[model samples]
Target chain A: MTGNFFYFLTFLTLFAAIGVVVSKNPVYSVLFMILTFFALTGHYILLNAQFLAAVNFIVYMGAIMVLFLFVIMFLNMREDTEQHKPVLSKIAAAIAGGILFVVMIAALKDVNTQMTTTAVFDSQIGMVENLGKVLFRDYLLPFELASVLFLAAMAGAVMLGKREPGEQNRF
Target chain B: MSSASNAYFTNVFIMNDIPEVIRTIPLNYYLYFSTALFCIGIIGVLTRRNAIIIFMCIELMLNSVNLLLTAFSSYRSDPNGQIFVFFIMAVAAAEVAVGLAIIVMIYRNVRSTDINILNKLKW
Candidate 1:
């Protein structure tokens, strides 16, 4: 039953991810991406990483994707009129992408050693308590650094979004 | 030959008794699946011209990494990877905040979200 569940969740994730790539309309793509994230959250739950699953839903599905939708709606451009990349560029991108995929697969062909073994944790381990303990102990510096980086990004976004007084007439 | 066959049977029996399917599959399968998803995301980001779709692809890639990290954490019997996944989530949130704000500002100027037109910085 669990195997079937994993297969189902994986199918949804892969399907939505493909939709994200193939959808021409930005709104549709964002919606599909949200579905993909939700399916991934399901996978995280199945993996017993309950906290990660919740965070995945809250952060990606709730906040980030809504921001994306707002930007799309605010632009309010005609989807049919949106300019696409040149045909040559598109072909080049495809070739480059294909080559990269081939190289990556070939690189992983020989290294077959297993990096980890199955060791299920206690239920409490994936809860907030264990996560907080480790975050505050072993990962303290990195966690703090992430917060500082977020602050910097916020300041940068404000600076970038701010318009000059005289620049309004140029547009 | 007979002794080796007996050992293989024992290993198979041990695997069959794992109560949870998550405990049975090799960790490499999860890692490889996530890697493929990440690769797909990368391809999407490179091939798509729409700014919003590009952002979505970036998000996809990040989620792939999160999946791999969580799987590794579970396999190793450690919660550190899960904690790291939390930090990654926070960073992704910040990224979306700043990325969309800039996209909105760009749209205000050009009236379009197509990335090919935003070549003002080209010298």
Candidate 2:
């Protein structure tokens, strides 16, 4: 049953991810991306990383995707104004991605080692209690730095979004 | 042999105590799945001209990495991988915030989100 659930979520994730790329309309793309994120959240839960699942739900699906939708709607890019990349380049891009995938598979296929279950598996390792202990202990410095990064990012976004006073006439 | 050992472990331990997903699905499957997802993101990035779509593809690639990290973290019973995944999410958020702001500013200048139009340094 769990395997079935994993397969289903995997299918949903891959399908929606492809849809996000294949859809021409920006709105449809954003919607498909949201779907993909949801499937990913489900996968996280299946993996027992419940906290990450919630964070992925809140951050990606809640915040980032909405921002994408807002930007798309704000731009009024409903029409297919994008000139498709040349057919040759499109094919070349597909081939390049395919080659990369094939190479990675070839290189990694022989390195298949199963996870050893002997090392006292802590089922609660993914829970917030254990994760928070690790985060606040070893990762404290980076955690604080991440906050500083967010502050800088927020400032930069505001600064960039701010219009120059006399530049309105140029547009 | 590994399956027989796993069965012994399950019999000795409570059924629910075992990591069912990890036991059932090989780690290689997660690796392969994430790799495919990453490649799809690459294809999208290479093929798409719209800046926002490309940005979305980049997010897709980040997600694939996050999935792989989570799988490894779970399978190994290590919390560090998930913590790294958390930080990656934070960084990605910041990146999107700044990147979209820049894209919006470019659109204001060029009045289009198409990447081809913005090629020239000085408009």
Which one wins on DockQ?
2
Candidate 1 versus the native: TM-score? 0.84
Off by over 4 Å in 1: A113-124, A167-171, B1-19, B120-123
Please give the lDDT score at residue B107 for candidate 1: 77
lDDT of 1 by residue, A1-171 (tens): 777787788888988998998787878888898899899988888777777778888888988888888777767745685667777877787677667767766776565534333333354467677788888999889988998998998898888788878776443
Q: Supply the global lDDT for candidate 2.
A: 0.89
Relative to the unseen true structure, what is the C-alpha lDDT of residue B79 in candidate 2, on a scale of 0 to 100? 92
User: Best lDDT goes to which candidate?
Assistant: 2
Candidate 1 lDDT over residue span B1-123, tens digit each:
223222222323234332253454555567667767887788787788788888888888888888988876765557877887888889888888888888878877777777879777867
DockQ of each: 0.43, 0.62
Model 2 error, position A47 (Å): 0.4
Provide the lDDT at A24 for model 2.
Answer: 86
Q: What tens digits encode model 2's per-residue C-alpha lDDT throughout A1-171? A: 888888999889999989988898989999999999999999999899999998999999999999999998888886468889999999999999999999999987987455545446677788888899999999999999999999999999999999998786553
- Which docking band does candidate 2 fall into? medium
